[model samples]
Target: MTTWDEHAAQLADTVTHPRSRWRDAIRATPRHLLVPRWWHNDLTGTLLLDGPTDPHRWMRAAYSDTTLVTRLGSLHADLAHPDDRPPWWPSSSSTLPSLIVRMFRHARPETGQNILDVGTGSGYGTALLCHRFGDQHITSVDIDPYLTATARERLADIGHKPLIAATDATGPLPDTYDRIIATVSVPRIPAPWLAALRPGGRLVTTITGTSLIIGADKTPDGGALGRVERDWAGFMGTRHGPDYPPRLMHQFPHARDQDGDDITTGRYPVLDIAEAWEVNTQLTLAVPGIETHFETDGDDRTAYLLHADGSWARAHGHWTDAPTVHQSGPRRLWDVLERIRHKLNIEGSLGLYGYRVHIEPNGRCHISQGGWTAVIE
Candidate 1:
């Protein structure tokens, strides 16, 4: 219907300046065809939204500038029933159009240069790249064979056929690229990617478990140096196989209700890591792989931090109130968070945004802002 096109134009209006290059591409591509079915949840159970059954709602979901979950845990939306209660984790999605355009702007690709599009979920991004750079110069890769195969078929339906391959993006790449834009986050920059980048090439990706977006250019000595973007963006962490590693819910029972090994009062006001971008990035860099959950009820707020290594922290408090923190395991979780909070208080801002990023050939990433620094080894 004409509504999808109107919605694309509406989405394009939100992105400005550098991202304007892909405005025409955004309007021309049909997102409805790419995402025939998707998943949504209201916390209690998941619902499958298919275009054929509910065209009106489907059009709204597909065209809006929002992420439409295509797969949850191991079940794809195409195979799921209306009443199935899948896991909350989003395994795959058609990323928001604005974010895709923003990332493309960050990559700064020219007309003739070869590009690699990692994480071809719905192939919408791939279609945009093909429309701009031509079919021969674009290669889209994903870990799942079914996804890649379906995406390839979808691309062909629009008469745009690019090289779609099913392979692990973190391992050996299929080809060298002038621009590598990944829609998936990685724990560390893979050495294979660094090697595959041509000299003076650029890589746009996010650090896993955080919203830190990096724009780095390849250096002469096989390393790359650049800076983090001022704005925050994140994607699903890279999946090595059919699914990601198991979550930390198994350790919940032990920390559900207890005095914990350590008890202390939080120094600052209750912080919701999800809403605090700068703090989230800083804490993620300081204590990598920490999982956070936050909830609010009237004046009271509750937060939980869990790690895969049996570490957990639960904080409960209200606005302007000192939160009583309960933490247990090998590491003191709240202590680390408090340290980050204190650093932010001293330094006007966390300085995580626009921090200098340096990636060595050995896969070590170094980030610095003012005197504070973090190294991901």
Candidate 2:
């Protein structure tokens, strides 16, 4: 097999663009050092460990561009020994390169502007910023002190020393910056981010409500104005400290265990959630706090939707069942999902695409769509 560096080189060659300057930075920096310890998450919680003790497995996992979860649910993956191969989902990771590059484009930092990076995952991004603007002009923050410390050491190993702080970015940022980029998604764009930007400065971040990428400039009037980049980039939502709010096991106790009520058969295989963002987001506008899950049992398929208001719905059907049938509660959850799906199919897509955010001086956010038609609050 080719050496890991060879793979990085190949990817760098293929992805050349105005955004490709970071490619060289990616190739030059040793990503493995920055992510020596990481964690993964699962339905139960996070599993902490040093991934793949086998030298071969370690090298392959370390070099691939895919994000590796280093920490989850208070378990640091780096801390786990080699003999232990624990099953867990990814909680935090070195985000995918394409998404990272799109974000850099959104920040639009000039050669002279100072930059701040929130969520110093692997310090890979910090090095990229430092490569362009020098370490003096970049500041990186993470909620975990160990992550910041590890990032600092590895960054220094590469001779890049942008500030890596162990602090909560949701609170006051350490300093004002000409550009701020965050790798974590937040449900709401924190008000302090607007306060931290210098006039005309840009803030590129993911809006938490959906997988929306927003790029806005700090106006002299104080609101930030920018539009969503046309891509889907998901990062773990920001955590106040070591971990985010735990998954509510009881919220879906029946999800994996008991048979659900109003359970009709399902016709579709498990669909990727990313594919439903537009319709889902649109539906959320009509009905908030509604979530969905899908499952399959060889011959049959099932989809579930739950709302905090104690309403739930389940749809069960197979190819044989056609005509997509299902059941619902006091509020019909399946109807809402199917309606959104149908609306998307009719419109050829959902309106959640290509949104623009207008942050007014008072911190109220106004979102708009094509032709800048603002979404009413």
Candidate 3:
């Protein structure tokens, strides 16, 4: 039987190069201990994989560089039954090891600096950081008490005793720090986070509803200015409570498999938001709360867009052909998307990743590059 430490080394070799400083830390941490039980998709529904029940399957999942959904909606996998299937999307997970390393690479952490690890889901990332920069210099926080307690206990077993607290990450932090690395996304830069960061400190986080990775440094004027990182990454948005806010699924009834009020031909090609990272990122920034779904069969492609306030759009067509677009409700959702597509067509790019980001003391985000500018208040 391959030991967990050897499995950790194999996982590290898969995600990190030989010369990477994070290699040793990844090799030492035992991920299976933190995530003893997780949910995996099955033909019928989600299947609970208990480590004690199936050690082989558990070891494979634990050592693999993939996300393990520990909590779905408000249901934690530890408490879920074998026959249960949580309807809601994943609320928390042990993020992929590769992405965790990618985030740390972007952070460029210095030795002996105080670090705040936000969204301590499974505390795997926190444990890795603790090993890199002793437990005294690291503080890991999460919104759920149960999750924080679980992580604290698991970290202790691994000889790590970082300060683990349960609190809303958007609100005031317990202490200041030289670095803030959030594994969760935020709609806007929280003012309290800005206040907690010391001068010359750096922040690494993803913008909510988009895949834009922001890397900014604190300035003397109580503001931060930086550019978007070229590589894109996304995580579940931060929540103030146990679960996220209500989704736009209410509009699904009127729009699902129904002809809309206005029907026309789409001026652009059919786009799968999941596959088109650049366009999806731009559309998300332009239309903040739009929900998307996409599918394809042979040469035929279909896409649907839904938004709160009763706006929806559906587009269907074959390859290289203009899609038949159907839209309804207060806003013409497809038209808004088309306008963005037109802008992209003319400018050759929306420059979303190239935008200069400015974070004000009040958490207002002002994004601009070239002659284009946008503000999120």
lDDT agreement of model 3 with the native: 0.88
Ranking by lDDT: 3, 1, 2
Per residue, candidate 3 scores C-alpha lDDT tens digits across 1-377 of: 98888899999999999999999999999999999999888657877789978888888899999999999989999888888877748899999999998998888889999999999999999999999999999999899999999999999998999999999999999999999999999988999989999999988999887888988889888889888887789899999898977666554866657899999999987888756666777777777777888878899998888888688999999987999999998889888878877888898976777579999988888888878787765
Off by over 4 Å in 1: 1-3, 16-19, 43-45, 295-300, 318-320
Candidate 1: residue pairs that collide: none
Whole-structure CA lDDT of model 1: 0.87
Question: Cα lDDT for residue 312, model 2?
Answer: 70
Error of 1 at 293 (Å): 2.7
Better of 1 and 3 by lDDT: 3
Candidate 2 accuracy as TM-score: 0.84
Tens digit of lDDT per residue, candidate 1, span 1-377?
65778876766675545356787787778888999999877845777888978888877777788899998888888778877877778989999988998888889999899999999999999999998899999999999888899999999998789999999999999999999999999999989889999989999999987888999999999989999988779799898999987777555866657888888888877778877877887778877889888878888988888887788998889977998889998888888888888988898787777889999987788988778678976
> Pairing residues by index, what is the TM-score of model 3?
0.93
TM-score for every candidate vs. truth? 0.93, 0.84, 0.93
What is every candidate's alpha-carbon RMSD to the true fold?
2.1, 3.9, 2.1
